[model samples]
Target: MTTTGTIRSATGYLRSWVEAQAAHRRVPGVQVAIRSGDELVLSAAVGVADATTGAPLSTGHLFRIASHSKTFTATAVLRLVEAGHMRLDDPIGQFVPELEDGGSPIARVTVRELLGHQSGVIRDGQDGDFWQLGRPFPDRSGVVAEVLRAGAVHRRNEHFKYSNVGYALLGLAIESVTGSTYAEHLQASVLEPLGLTRTGAEYDPARAEEYAAGHTGLLLGEDTRQTIEHVDTRAMAAATGFWSTAEDLTAYGAAHYLGDERLLSDDSKRIMQRLESIVTAYGTEVGRYGVGMALQTVGERQLVGHSGGYPGHITLTLIDPVDRLVVSVLTNAMDGPAEDLAVGLVKVIDVALTPRTEVPPPPAGAPPLASFTGRFASLWGVLDVAELGGRLVLIRPTLTDPLPGVEELEVVDASTLRVAAQPSFGPAGELVPVQRDADGRVVSLRFGGVTSRPVDEFRRLRSGMTHLA
Candidate 1:
């Protein structure tokens, strides 16, 4: 179990780092939510919802959490199984008999195989132009045609092969078994039961302004990104068509924790989390997949969650079942750093929870820790000083991952911080002197001989500097 103190302290540092990193990466918008044990520790949003309009983003903004739809689909399937409506070993042809007519290899694909991505179904079919917005997403008839059109590209259970078509078939199966649409069934069975009001199986145009507009990536030597319109996924809502906020996503992740009976029994969760396939790309092991969920190893902790990649949104959610910790990071950009941000949150929490035995006390007349924290810059790069778990740490704001080679600092006096512990190459035992304005605002700080000014002041000074011979 994770202590509340640990999460609260970690989030204190994480909030500042998240805000700075989004600015540094030039990401259009980012939404993050963290849950530890039974508490919602943090909910934060940074940057703008629309780059063109510069609409400020909020925690309530919804993002297209693409492939994360699979997790919900899998949960729905398991619920049906619990009710004796379906079984994992059931063949697809039993529910959709039309699939068996064309000598399509998918006719024999089992529910379990599809759930674990072992069905050998073609990935989005040959004409997956819908992904690139060249055409609209397929309808139910089109999805069935896509499955029959390509059939199986590999032997069933040969290896893990991700297939959006496969999951779309599962959605159809759910609809057939329940006699309801996929969206309606999922809403009544899953989202409503979980009380997740901000989540939906597909895009809803009625709530347009509530959604954070997606943006194209910085592509083809273009620095500015254009907003992408939201489109209904049609028949493929199960595989890659879900919209949610970070807050709601974390709540959904929490219900997946082992032994939690809110959704499924422990027996079912064990099966869902059991390793079913090793996801590989280019002959190298990339990740591990279970029945709908993704498993990851971060430091010594094991996490289960999913990542999503929609047209203009990138999102990731990670859950530490043992500690009962959940984190979700959603971004409205084609090249959002959602995974890295989530991993950084985990690392920061780990650091906060790790016991420290040598923290020095603040010197007399020292400036408050809050007063010394801000983003500082130099010709080298940008760095942030943040107070984490009652201690101060200096982190590089420009790095995609924020935790590597983090430096700890101790209060020295009203104008200084002592580098307590850092990498050997860093200024580990030196004093960083602070310069302040008459209003008690930090103007600059010097690490050893190198001076770092407040980011705003540094930019202003650089703009006025004269060229030297």
Candidate 2:
């Protein structure tokens, strides 16, 4: 059975790519999910869910997505705000008064600040030793005490400071406002409506067999990986505690799309996706942060999503709003290359979906652009000239990977051409000067001080050719 669509070839390419990357990264397990609109276009998984037991990973295996839970919590908060239960500007003290009454300055932080990570709340308590798998995550009471210990790390809206503790307080505020536990409120407000059955605020002991055990020490290679313990994050679940499968998470991500009314209004979605702050997260120069997500521009495409890095898990998700594409890569290893893999997969799919220019066969006695075609070799690498949509184009070729792009070439009397709609050498545009042999046979092409000769040395014997002129 063959699949068909703009992404049909992409899934196969992605599957192989994931397989190679997982092996290269020595990650125990990996799962990827991609969706186009409401359809699940691809869900591929590789490696083992448990390196110790050698359990194969699958799209259904639950992964502790860590910080991705912030997007969920932020979504839930936005839902309440739209429902008149809360407002973005409302002071945190109004809901969870413990901090205010307890003399913690975080009470003065606004919901907007908390949602955007501008609340100036400490990221984690001083003893974030919990993340090392040495100590258990804090409970509800412990979490509140940690907030008290957290205090303020910076001034409100001063800069994009991340705060896991601030998100935990948001959870507490949700509990206080709804008179329900954070788990219950999130489940009722977000999961049920979105039909996300495989997602939850915390690990479920009932589904213990389905839960992939986290691993550590991949630095020593695959064989040396040891199973890390899994403990309930309790109150911190809202910040970094949600466990979900790749498919479910992608589905949840799709709900944030503009036309999707199943979970959030278009207005709410806009607000949540808005770039509220400039930030650098997890050592990556992420372009911006939204209400609870990260925004990046890859090539000409705008992608908005979140990255998750828990103790034994690392994941990256991206959604292309213009194309309604959602892609997620999840891995069950501390050293997993989820971000690079996810971004690369997105780019691969983007290429697969791009409509290749269709050029009718050159008319008989045509300018014979084929002379300009064929591979050219230089010190830098190999570049290919090809005809597309009846136009000559320049393309750089790679040995193992697909060509990323082709620049359209405008022929100026056969030898001189300028790049179209792109800049090559100069800021706006640059000229590509092609030199021919004495016989007017193509020999060498030069651009931006870089030169390439015909891969076929026979072309060197042509009439107008240089070096041998």
Candidate 3:
């Protein structure tokens, strides 16, 4: 740990660093909030809400939070569960009868599976053009028909595959069980009760002037002169369509971490955060997926959180359950730079949250003689390294263009090297850690959940890299 002065300086540095990254990455707007214990440690806004209009973004500016809306949906389901209206193990088909019409039996999919993203439902929301571009958005029945027509990608409970359709179905289940529309039920059950007046799924055209204009990143191999097209996604109302502010998300995160009896029982909250499945890397448990959150360990501390991305928006929310600290970053544009900025901000917040203690000096010796240096490749791309100034310098060529060449790599330990480059960083710096073997050869790598490696290559690389650098 370090002193308060060190923490404050780190926080200030992070704030400026993230702002600079956001500007360079062409991110139109961003808002970040950090909560430690019950106190709001930091909440600030940077960049513009609408780049075309040059409107300054503020903490109060609303942005469509995209899949982050799933947390709200899950909360609504939990509220119903609290009231004994439904059980986690209840078959979703029992509530939404239409879901069972396909040859696939709905009884096989449970409420828990949907919430945990194990229902094997194909993610039909990817075909957003059909709904976003003037075509009518499907209601519950229409979405069900799409799923049946598309068919399941895998059997129910087969593995952890994220499905926006699964969540949409869960929303419909809430409606069926409560006899209310998804929005209405959510408003009555979660938002109204929590006094979150700013949160909702409705896209009010009248308020469009106040809403931030969504901006997409210019596609690669396309005309860079033409800005990525922006469109109002009213059709994604249930899957990726909910507007909120950092202030509202802070309140939501606090409710979850601090145990709000009004919304859910402490027991249920525990269940929500509990790890339901052990996700593997080379057949070893590296991470776990809970009801609607990801469970990961940073050193000895376990973090619970989730990340959301839409066409023109990206958001990340993470919680340090031990310290009751929450860090959230929201951006209005989907440009490549947003994720890196968000992840850097999370590290700064984490440093601020950590208590002052004796600082450990930088690793002794000339960077361990570069015992691990070589070429490593995965589906993610490639990592090439060489000994530089007695330390290993890793080169990640997968970074999106517009970034400087050969970014510096941070050594998590002796064996793991994480590239804190653009398009990969999150509020928690989640997309780093290019893992290597004891012999300093790359064995496996982790970016978010998906891990990649060479077949039967682990044995040859077993002693390649040492413990994280």
Candidate 4:
């Protein structure tokens, strides 16, 4: 687990990096939150909540955290199982008897299979255009009708096949057995217990303005993104219809850690996090799925969390149980880089938590580390000189994963640094001259004999340069 002191030491740089990445990636807005143990180490927002109106995004704004609802529904079902209200082996058709008619194969699909996405249920029926908002999301009768109408797509337990409809059936089963709506049960059993005041099982129209407006992606020949309206998911709420902020989402994730009895028993959490299916891409194991949970391994550390995609928002939350660390990234753009941003945070934190003994101490009379730290812009791209764990390193903030190609620095003097080490093909042994204005603020620098300047100065210089004759 990343200790509290280690996380706090990196949060200052992390915030600035997130701000730069959001602007460079052209994401309209992003919300980020981090939790270590019981403390919220960071809650930050960058860019505009509504690009059309230029409203600055804030941590208070909510995002339609679609698909994260599966975690909540899964928790509710497990709680019921613990209370002796239901069994994992029970066929789902017993609670929602509508599918038993016509001797459908879906009648034999067990609750465990649905939870693990092994039921082979259809992805979303023949016309899942509801995702595109062409029609209203299905209600109870519509959910039942879709199952009866389409039946099963493949044999049960054949392989992992994600189906939003399968979760919708679980919602119905929760209602039938508990005699309460899914929202009510979830609120009482999970949200309220976790004290996630900013989260909800569905979109609440009363707080409409508090919700970040979803936007169209940069694709589809559109020059700019247009806002999309939030509509209730109706019966599909269990699968993809929850709203939350990065802070509350991380708070919810913290409860899933083992031994945090506020949510599930450690044994149940182990069951929920066990590898039930391996998601493959081109014969490579890309990801793993547990009972309604997504499990990942990042840099020898285990992680469990989920990613959400709604009409205009893309979000992800990762929990490191061993380190007791959690990170959530929420974006109000259809093509938001939530996954990249979330993982980037983890990588940087890992770098911060690493022992500094491997990094050499500065030479005598070396200048303050902050003096040379800034963003330097060249005609080709941008590079950031940052002080992490009291060591100066050059980072390229434009790439999807920004930590690769990082170069360590050994200060030669107040205005010079030598690239001490880096990966192959990098300028591992180059002297960089730092330039400063009269106020001692960094204004320019040179890497590998290539001149770079501050962003504004570089733009001005480019605009005034004469074209080749």
Candidate 5:
């Protein structure tokens, strides 16, 4: 539906925006690809794969996709569901014997809840030692043991709280059902059939030079320092540990948009795209937990996508099934503005998806200043707002201590304000846009996949509040 001229303009703008943002953030490498229907619309790379080695990134350069790998894991499970090997409502105890008598009634945890992130299991591998140091990640038994020891966060099917541990258990279920490892099952069922040569769960040591090195910005505290940490997370193999490229990601997105015999049926794909949860009170957007994919509406149109963040990488892949358009973005730096870039790319594609007619250019300046101060909560985290010196200050309840200081807010409209916080020892500032309802009430705020809105009572509050003003 997008006109040729508008599509060209959008592609050019996306390339320019991504390049500039990557450079400003000191992100060494990035790969982006856009697809419409089964046709590849655009595929490009920017910056260097290795900042130290000076290798220019290409569409072939693989980066750790982190939790985006969850899609693959979920796909493998769905394959079993389709083959009658397992049921979506099957209990975890049916597969893993260790979890059967764990004394926590693990049998009550269904496979669907695990995939939907409603199993109420504790989030795995978040301890300080897991990320900071090269701590050995737990295996299938180890992760299950940890969950049993820690216990569930809430009753089963109570609410939507993301749990890596739940997916990890699903991975175990995959192995038990297929009589093979999670990696092997995925390769056979999803990757190989899809012709994704550059995607896999295991990181090949021989191809280490081919993979992009992950980087992190310097810590901004009493001392300012830069650090490059390599993510060696084999323990998260089934949860958040897969490496992929833009080319492979685009192909996968296309398969989802265009169903294949080796993968899901059209009916199954439609079921996957249905919203399982109404994340907001307005119900304008529904987060449907299909087999392994999340379906949500952007405006009146439905979009299917997922985002992932690790210590050294941030990745987002979104597909608009209506127009059969897919946008995939990957960055080497963890804290980079990958989410914003993804959103911007999607907007460009949407503009291109239909004819564009402009009568006149709007005013060049921003809207009048308006303070965005309120409390927003969701399943993941909470955002508390305060007005200071004509600016909006926000603090995350999980982090202790007030924000460094007040930050400037740019009013986008009467109901939206974009808050810009100073770079955390990087060249790029953290940009968060907060949206309010017509009543001037904070309805929702999004920073990556972490969205907090009213009516979400399962809030994880931390004693130490860190202000990023």
Candidate 6:
């Protein structure tokens, strides 16, 4: 998504690069969606949704969004609090009486502890092999039985301990208070209110054709994929049993922002997204967690959402509350780079929206410089020649942090330029000449005694390099 232009044009460029990245990574399939407030700015999918059947992916296809289910569960809990049905500080024993009867330490943990992962509740059950499909996920009876056998791992509010079982207990609490199943309560109270028609609390066999098949590689160097079987999570579904599409997920994410009356009130949203605890598992770069959503700090933006890791599917939904921007990425492969893809897509949109500082120095700009701006490639990799601050610079677009190699392009006549700003690239005034085509358009560029071929319609963006020369 390198080429700078209008958001629509930039999104068009992003779609092609995303498809190409998915192909290069050998991901079976992927779907991505970007939103500006409530409007869907970009929604695209590529590759096969089902590797065995080779069905192409669609933007509407469902993905098992794993732990993203926690966010919905959290939302449902907050709605109950809004209705004055229950308070965050309510003790679990008040609702799920089984806890007190079973003599579990979890009984002492407050509802707020469970919501913020401060309950120190066991993540899954004893022998949580259900994650690998070796055993079925626990039912309500099984959950209660586990609570009886094993309780909280640490004192309440001791640390940030992520617990799937904690959410299951919250589900039980919701059911006990509302006199309805967690799924039914969530549907009537949360999903429908947010207009998330494509989202489901549990896997629906009737919609099997629309669901993406999940594939996992059990061991290292295992390029071949093994399809993960679909099963009901039952009680634990509140923690990991949700399915959704990227477009729908982003729309749902947008509802959590302020000014969106479709879901939580601004006060409730603040309660949900308030950075309750910082996760030690993740460094400060990812920030902390608030209620069910994971808060990440990217630049000055506070991106909040949740990530889901199912056996065969990996998904992510991040929303920039300050910008009212949301990005969601879903993949069917277990090793799919959904987080990276989502972050990269967000960067692309942010760059496209911001005004470019480099506008080509004065005059109407040299005609030949237009040819110099296309991406040049070679056996080593790609060399991105673009105008930055009215000066041309070569950059490598593939690196996660790509500023060290930036070498400014100083115009020397129209066909030749000098690589400035770095001595390791060659001498400061190293001469680089551009080759032309029969149409009198610049084609290939020669640098460091090597002639590099330019790729047609290729764009390399380096706005992150603005701090450098």
User: How do all models score by TM-score?
Assistant: 0.94, 0.76, 0.69, 0.96, 0.71, 0.85
Expressed as tens digits, the lDDT of each residue in 1-469 for candidate 1 is 3477667867766888888779877899999999987789999999999999999999999999999999999999999999999999999988888898777778899999999999999999888889879999999999998888776888899978989999999999999999999999999999998999999999999999899999999876678999999999999999998999999998999898887889899888888888888888898999999999999999888898999999999999999877799999999999999999999888878766763335588886777888998888887788788777667778786687666657788888878888876457778889999999999888999986688898888988775544653
* Between candidates 3 and 6, the TM-score winner: 6
What is the C-alpha lDDT profile of model 6 across 1-469, one tens digit per residue? 3222244555654575576567657889999988776578689999988887788899989999989999999999888898899999999988989888878888888888898899988889788999988888999989988877876687898878889999999999999999999889989998898788999999989998888889884357666776777778899988999999999998899898778867788888888788899766544543489988888876557889999999899999999876788889999988998887887766655544542233324234556554567667665566767544334656555544334445666776667777664437464558888877888666778877676676542223233234565
Kindly report which residue stretches of model 2 are placed more than 4 angstroms away from their true locations once superposed: 1-4, 220-223, 280-287, 355-469
Which of 1 and 6 is the better model by TM-score?
1
Whichever of 2 and 3 has more TM-score, that candidate is 2
The root-mean-square deviation over C-alpha atoms between each candidate and the true structure, in angstroms, is 2.2, 8.6, 13.4, 1.9, 14.4, 6.1
List the candidate 6 regions with Cα displacement exceeding 4 Å: 1-6, 281-287, 354-376, 383-397, 400-436, 439-443, 446-451, 454-469
Question: How displaced is residue 113 in candidate 4, in Å?
Answer: 0.9
Task: List the candidate 3 regions with Cα displacement exceeding 4 Å.
Answer: 1-11, 125-136, 221-238, 278-288, 336-339, 353-469
What lDDT score belongs to each candidate, Candidate 1 first? 0.88, 0.77, 0.63, 0.88, 0.66, 0.79
Q: Point out the worst 10-residue segment of candidate 6 by lDDT.
A: 457-466
- Model 1 pairs in collision: none
lDDT of 6 at 396: 57
State the lDDT at 197 in candidate 3.
69
lDDT of 5: 0.66
Error of 6 at 409 (Å): 7.6
1 or 3, greater by lDDT? 1
TM-score-superior candidate, 3 or 5: 5
Candidate 4, poorest ten consecutive residues by summed lDDT: 351-360
Candidate 6 colliding pairs, count: 1
Cα lDDT of candidate 4 equals: 0.88
Error of 2 at 115 (Å): 0.8
* Candidate 5: segments with Cα more than 4 A from true spot: 1-10, 125-128, 221-232, 258-261, 280-291, 355-357, 360-469
Q: Write the per-residue lDDT of candidate 5 for residues 275-326, one digit (tens) a residue.
A: 6665443545444555467665554557787777777778888877666778
lDDT per residue as tens, model 4, 1-469: 3468778877888898898889888999999999988899999999999999999999999999999999999999999999999999999989988788756789889999999999999988888889989999999999888888885998999978999999999999999998999889899999999888999999999999899999989996667999999999999999998999999998999998887988889888888889899988789987899998999887767899899999999999999876789999999999999999999888887766763225457779877998988888877788888877667877787778876746778888888888875455766777888888898888888898888888888888875554653
